[model samples]
Every structure is written in structure tokens, then in C-alpha cells.
Target: MSTRSTDPPPIRSRIDRALIRGAAGATAVLLLTSCATLSSGNGERDNVPEDVSTDITDEPVELTLAYTDDPPSTELVEGFTEQHPNVSIELQQTPFTDYVKTVTLSMSSDEAPDIAQYNPGAMRSLIPSGHVMDLEPYVEAYGWEESFPEATLEPLRADEDATRFGTGSLYAVPGALSVLGVFYNRELLARAGVEEPPATFEEFEDALAAVDEEGIAPFSVGGLEVGGFQVWNTLLNAFGDHEAYRDWVHGAPGSTIETDEAMTATGILTRWVEAGYIPESANATSDDDAKAAFGNGESAFLMIGNWAAFEMEEALGEDVGFFLLPGEDPDQVPMTSGSSVSYTVSSGTEHPDVAAAFLDYLSSPEAARIQLDTGFMPVDTDASTGEGGVLEEINSVYGTAAEQDGIVPFPDFATPGMIDQLTPGVQGLIAGSTDEETFLSDLQAEWDRVHG
Candidate 1:
């Protein structure tokens, strides 16, 4: 979640410059292929079996994978190789900042990896290029619809144009899942005389006031990066209409973010900034800095995804706890933005059956254990994560949402350059340089630019 550039230059300066370059490069490519549809590898049918096979030949097979996320990807690969001794997987790791660009280029080459971590930005181009396999046949064969959560799979589905989502062919399957929530310092809350995690947004606000009164920074926010919009995103999930938000994020026709619910969510964020619940220095902070501040006990709360769980637990141990951002009403169905460290097979792979079997392994009970141990929500939502702790707390809350189909795609996924818009828009909001109307308008404008 940090995503702070290692360059000596400012984070915003670097990100903005990168976005401009990326957008221009993408635009040139898009124009050249605007008339194209998702290709299925020159109409040559794959040699994969129609039914999911339980046993693969004992003959040795080798695969190469390109990925960014570590814990899950590395461990998942280890788990897969352990099960099938005859298969060997080689990994090519890239930094998160360079991953999209690097993976996209490599995947387009004739020597593409057998499997690569799925990135929506790259997939927009890769899908239409016929380089990535459409996993519909495998999905049905493996009964992945029953194995993986529906919400997780929905975002990976796209039309032939690779424009609209939630329908058409599937592109990938999740190796591990994650959810967004609030990570709080248990000692800080107790010090402020708050007994437990707030079950409603009203109570959460009150806790913020109490903590502020106790001379503590209520929330640690990294307004300089994705951290800022992540806060706005959490609030929007709690306050907005889930289906409408989902439709907009998935590029459904006629979807819009300029709703009364979105206005209410934005107002709540602005009010928090004004109330000093979110500090003025937040705009200058990096996500790593914010997480450090919270872990060091300088702040009471940090809003982020489960990906931060390992570091927080390492830094704070039992002092930290997690809970979903509570909704406006206590009885409201819980919702949050979540995604997976998913992988896709290359159409160029010589061992299609071996590659598909590796994917199928992701849903197995053994892989679920590896997923939980690596601090990610398992693909099997019903998989047990053991007794009480921050992970248990996360699993309990995340399971409820997944069962109710409340996990929605993140807002930035709506468009390729949307993060550039969301990050800066939230930065302006915190700085009082942009009004609520302008912020919402900018978000909707970006959506229109991409989906129109």
C-alpha cells in the first residue's frame, strides 16, 4: 500500500510524470487496435481436456511466472510444486511500480511466461491481443464458480472488447484474497477509555473525538499516495449503494459516481479533515510513514487493506486490532473493497494441462492453509484461520461480507489512470484546495473518459 517512489524527487511529481507517460503510451497502442476484439489465439483449439483431471502425468514439466506480490505468490508456488513433484516453476519478480509495464511487454513477446500475475491495466491490452488465455473452459471444468468467491471472479470477467466487466469470459483465478478495513491500536483505544471497536459510523466518530481530546492523532493517513483515496473508498463503501458503486467500478453502462450517497461520503471525509481527526500533516505523509506512525503508537487508527496485516502485527503485536469500517446503520450489510493476488495462464504455454492444474490447486484446502499463513484471506472463504488474533478478527468480518456478496472492486480499477485522479483529488480535499463537487466531478469525468 505504500507505493512511495524510491526516487529523491517528490512522490506526486514522480507519479504524475509516470501517469502522463503511461497514458500517452497506452493511447497510441489503443488507437492502433481500437477495432479489434478479444482474440482466442488464431482459432486453434487448445489441447486441454474437457474435464478437470485429478492426476497429471509424472513426467517432469517446467513453467515460468512473472509476479510482483511476494508472500502469497512465492508461497503459493512452493505449495503447488510440493504437491506435484514433477513440475518446476521459475519466477521472475518485478517491483510493484514497474510490474504493469514490465509484465505487459514480456507477455506480448513470443517468449511469454507460462503464467503471469494478472494486472487489469496490462490485461486491457493483453486480453485483446489474444496473448492471455480466456479461462472460461477451465473455470467450468474445475467448478471454480463453486470453489472461488463470486465477487472475486466477477472483476476478472470482461466482454469481447475487454471493456465491460461482470459478464462474458473469465481471464484469471485468485491465489489469495484481501479486504480493506481499519487497523487500530488496542492500547490507544483503551487509553482513550473506549471499550471496543465501534459498530457504527456515529460511534467511530465519537471515538475519534475522544482520542483527539486525549492528545493523540486520531488517524494516520498517507494523503500523498493511494492511502488517501483508500480512506475515501472505505467511507464510500460504508455509505453508498453497493450495487451502484459496483456497477460504476465494473464499467457497466450508465453507471455514475455522482450520487447523493457519494456526496454524503465525501462530506464525511471533509468533515473529518476539518475536525482534525485526520491530521494536517497527512497530506505530506507516505503510506509507510503513516503505518510507522500508527505502529509506533503515535496514532490511534490506520485505514488500509489486509496486505498491511503482517507488518502491523510484527510492529505492534497484540497492541493492534482490525475491524471493517462500520456502516451508517448497525444493521446495514457490510461492504468493502477487496482484490486478489491472482494469476493467469499464457496462451503460448506448451503445458496447458499442467498450468491449469496449478490454478486448480489454488482452491484446495492445502493452498487455503498457505494463503492464511501468508496473511491473506484464503480463496476458500469458509476455510478456518484458527483462534483469536488480528487475522481471526479480519477473517470473521471478511467472511460475513463475502457470504453476503458485499466485496466490491476498488474504485481505481474503473480506469487505467484513475489512481492519478483519485490520489490527487483526495490530496486536494485534505488541503482544502478542492471542493466536494469538484472532487466528485473529476472522478466521474475520468470514468467517462475511459468507458464512454
Candidate 2:
């Protein structure tokens, strides 16, 4: 989702530049900002119930939860395990780089966890194979649909034309909540003499230019393989003149990435690399490295999700800020975001009722507060529009853009292995191994392979 940036120059100087941009050749920096577990006013709240716990049965009804390493948010989880002591859980952490494959192999096994942490494409394979359960009945009985915002369920709900859309039935429960947006440092802007973050694209570029004159990197990206893909993927949705964003994602044949809008975004992104507005070496940088660089003040901006809030605060301190990624056309979608996180009942579960109960419990307004306090957009209805919870500053941008009908889901969330198909080509694009025409053609080729 797009973050709302203060007008003129939403980003300022609190950049932590010491974080190294590492993917291929770059090294990571160790610039640490002031440490205090920063919060924007009412940061984290004691929202977890006095007896916060998971429902685990002691009769060996065990499930394993798989997650990639982002350990800070689990701050309170370890302290709240008393309620459901009967159930035991195994925590499996994978590197973000290896998560996709690890999830795939585990799912195909009979020994798969009854409950596991699943991401976008992981459920696609299982849902289609009838390996997962349909949660609709449970959803109805529990009123999950009533309290649940339909948008939050978009990732789980397959379109009626499932063959055409590849949205298949809901499979895994959504675990994490995240928001994707362009991040900037306030102190960096002040050093560049920029007054505020730009509301429009032209001004945004101007800020990049101001940062450029000082010989500092203006943007950070993990362009090699998946790293380089994030920025391009983001821009594709923001400026997608054609509805190619979803079509390209669903891969329902003839879905080429070479739409006019796709080409424009690619060209501009490539130019950003050439102009040094972004690090030319981003082609080899990992996502972590780029994030660290931005946090350490080596770069001026980062296009990232809300989960990275803690990391940024750790690297850049209280002076850090965010804003919406400006779209080429304001009337177009403000910017695109992924469903990122959601919860669904496992089709294989014998205790569907119990699982569904857990989801409902997790969706409560109180639950939403727990999530907001974790620094993410909540699926709960109240948090999205209720009192000033979460970052009102950031939510203002997201809410305004969404209200204007300016939101789109991430391409990967719409289909299976979009990242698998799109990333190599984007990495190729960055290296100039493929021209704009061929990049689109390749994208279409992948789409055809999947649909036909």
C-alpha cells in the first residue's frame, strides 16, 4: 500500500548510510542510529489479552509454523504461551532467499505441518490439487466474512472463473500483516536542502537530483534476481496504464509484461540506474543490503513494506519518515500493494471448527490493535478507518488513495510463481541483456506457459 508523505518533501535526513548494499559485490554497513525501540507517539500498546496464548493440544496435536527471519516483532509472542499449553509448536525459520523452495518441499510431504506459515504461491499449488480445504462454510458460521474486509480476503478468494483468473479457493491462513511503500529519511532531505517530500512525480525526481549533487545514492533496490524485481514490480502497478498488472499476474495467456505502461516503467527504472539517482550497483544488492543502506543514511529512499519499520528505526532513528510512491497519473491507481498477509483454515484439518475459531479470535478489533501495534495495516474493519491508530500520518496517505479507488493487489498474490517468472527477466532488464520489447515478450511467454 502507498504511504502518505508530507507535502513538498516527505523524506528528511535521518538516513543510516552505513548499511552496505550487498547482493553480488557490495558489502553491508553497520551504521546504528539511536536505540530505544522508537515509536511514532503511541508506538506499541498493551493490547494483547492479559492471557494471550495459542490453542495447542497436549495430545500431540502439533503444528509447525515456518517464518523467515524478521525477529523483532515476535517480542511479545514468547511471553504469552500459557493459555493453550496442551498444543506444542515447532518454529521453523528460513532465509527469505530460501523460503519459497522450503515451503514447496514441505507441502508435498505427508509429514507437513497441519498448520504452517504459507506465503503467496505456496497455497496455489495445494489449493488446485485439493490439498487444502474450503474455508467458506467456516467463514460463514463464524461471520469471518462479515467482520473481515473483502480486500483482506482477496488473496484467499479465488475468482468465480477460477480457470481464467487462477485465484483458486482459499487455502492457508494469512499470518503476517505488511504495507509496501516508498520510504525516505528526513535528515537526508535536510542535508539536501529539500523542504518536504513530494506529492507528485516531478518533485520526487527533483529531490533525487538534489541528493545526487551531493554524491549520495538517492534510491535503494535489490535488483539482482528478486532484489531488482521489487522496484520494477512496484512501478508497474503504480503506472500501469493497461490492466496488465493483474493480467500479467494471473498469466491467463497473452498476458505480456510489454504493455505501453510496462515499457515506460522499465525505461524510467533503467534510467534511474543510469542517472545514479539510484545505486548503479543495485543490480547485485540483496534486499537486506539496500534496506540497511537506506537506514544507515547511505541512500535517501527505500521502497519497502510496513514490516521494515522496526529495522528502519533501528538504523535511522526517530527522524525516519514515509510517503506514498507518487504515481505518474494521480487519477490512476495511487499505487499497488500485495495482500501480503491473510489467514485461512487448512483444508486438511479435522478440527475445522477450532481452526476457524482461532481465525475469528485473531480478527477481533483487539487483535487488530495488536497488529497495528506491531506496525502493520490490520485486517480488522475498525483499524482501517477507526480512531487514530497505526501511523495516522502514513494511514492518511493509504486511506486517501484507497478511498479514491486507487489500490491494486500485488501481481504475485494474484497468480502462482509470478516472482519466479518475472524476476529473472527484470534482473536481465537491469543488466541490459534483454531489450524492452523482449522483456515484455518473455513475460507473455511465461504467461502463456502457465495458462495454456
Winning model by lDDT: 1
lDDT values, one for every candidate: 0.80, 0.54
Q: lDDT tens digits, residues 303-348, model 2?
A: 8766666567667765678777777554545765645344433444
Of candidate 2, the 10-residue stretch with the lowest lDDT total is 1-10
lDDT of 1 at 422: 88
Candidate 1 local Cα displacement, residue 112, angstroms: 1.1
lDDT of 1 at 99: 79
Say which candidate scores most in TM-score: 1
Compared with the true structure, model 2 gives a TM-score of 0.74
Candidate 1, poorest ten consecutive residues by summed lDDT: 6-15
lDDT for 101 in candidate 2 is 68
lDDT (C-alpha) at residue 121 in model 1: 79
